[model samples]
Target: QYLCAIRPKDGRLVLSTMVYADEVNASDDIAELKAVSETELPDKELKMARQLVDSLAGDFDAERYTDTHRQKIMALIERKADGDTGLVEAPEAEAAGEVVDLMAALEASVAAAKDARKRHPTGVDEGEGEGEATTPEKAVRKKKSA
Candidate 1:
């Protein structure tokens, strides 16, 4: 529903993302992924996965997120226009193929999301009105003035 272009095909609605498929590259990235049917997965694993997703139901709304990346870019442009000489340093490169603890990460995320929900039950962030969902101070840090 979020996609701009959608068309009806054989009584089913499908997203028309491109006008032409000439530039499309249907390579290994697409071919490598295979959907595992419910029958293929063990019942216990399927049930646990479903339960985990159910627990995170309230935390995964698309509307709750703001485009922080775009906002940062816009802010940088404004800073440049205002004659601010600060150099926008490139972010440090991360280690290639770092293994992560998925379960621990998920648990931490759940805890943080639940805490945020408790703080704001309506899902509307506190500082969203001024074109940001987070505090301006947190978004751009400056040196303390004596």
Candidate 2:
């Protein structure tokens, strides 16, 4: 029901009642109704407002989005089920070439040795055994095993 409060002086419209259509367009004046004081809202108006809020709360269609990984997996599964035995071809093997540069090889070896020393600082290099004596003392003397 449309309402109008007429001014007594010149019979002009002072206030108009709030409107709510069955299906409100995206660009409607819902802001005016929102500004209305909670105490001033009639029970019917409050109910309608609650209904409108509830209607707008959830409207997303989750089915519209596709999971690409899942789709690919499903396709592979279906292919396997139907015995689609086509395998993707592997690349042709090419002839292996030597490194060819001596200085570059030495640099790489030095770098690797430095990295190994960094990994184990006090560790023995190459031929040194823990229980074995040093070679310097045995240089001038020969030992007889008992």
Candidate 3:
């Protein structure tokens, strides 16, 4: 039997192999397989770049992210599976006929998003029932009521 072990030695990673045998001298069979050098110390430019990246890093909260488009598609599939064909067709996107003022368009989009956030603080649309009761009875009641 052979066992491989890794350890840090002189700021480098050393891989050592040990042999275990019932009838053989294990010490004579043991070998220092290889040593992997540590990463080189960062240069001034690399240090600056690393610092810039570290400064931009922030805590990641996965709960704050959602695939709304995918959720919508799944909901549509569910509705179709349930034999509900009253799906609303989305309006066609109009082509950009001419060059638009980029800054003005960006400002308008920002303002619209702000207004939407104010209207739906929970980020859920009205009648979407995002936080509603999930019991089967409640679901049936909601469907009947609707």
**Candidate 3 TM-score, true structure as reference:** 0.35
Mind giving the per-residue lDDT tens digits that candidate 1 earns over 1-146?
12233333332233343422333333323423223221366679757766764564332233444556667999999999999998889999987997899999999998898678646534546445633334233335588999
Residue pairs in clash, model 2:
none
Q: Which stretches in model 2 have alpha-carbon errors above 4 Å? A: 1-58, 88-146
TM-score of candidate 2 versus the correct structure, residues matched by position: 0.21
Cα lDDT, model 3, residue 119 = 63
Better of 1 and 2 by lDDT: 1
Candidate 3 or 2, higher TM-score: 3
> Could you tally the backbone clashes for each prediction?
0, 0, 0
Give the Å shift of residue 47 in candidate 1. Answer: 27
Off by over 4 Å in 1: 1-12, 16-63, 98-146
- Judged by TM-score, which candidate is best? 3
lDDT-wise, the better of 2 and 3 is 3
Q: Kindly state the number of residue pairs that clash in model 3.
A: 0
True-structure lDDT of candidate 1: 0.54
lDDT of 2 by residue, 1-146 (tens): 43332221121112332233332233225454334333365679757765655564443333444556566778978998899998745669897987689999899999898668545635444566654433332335568999
Give each model a TM-score.
0.28, 0.21, 0.35
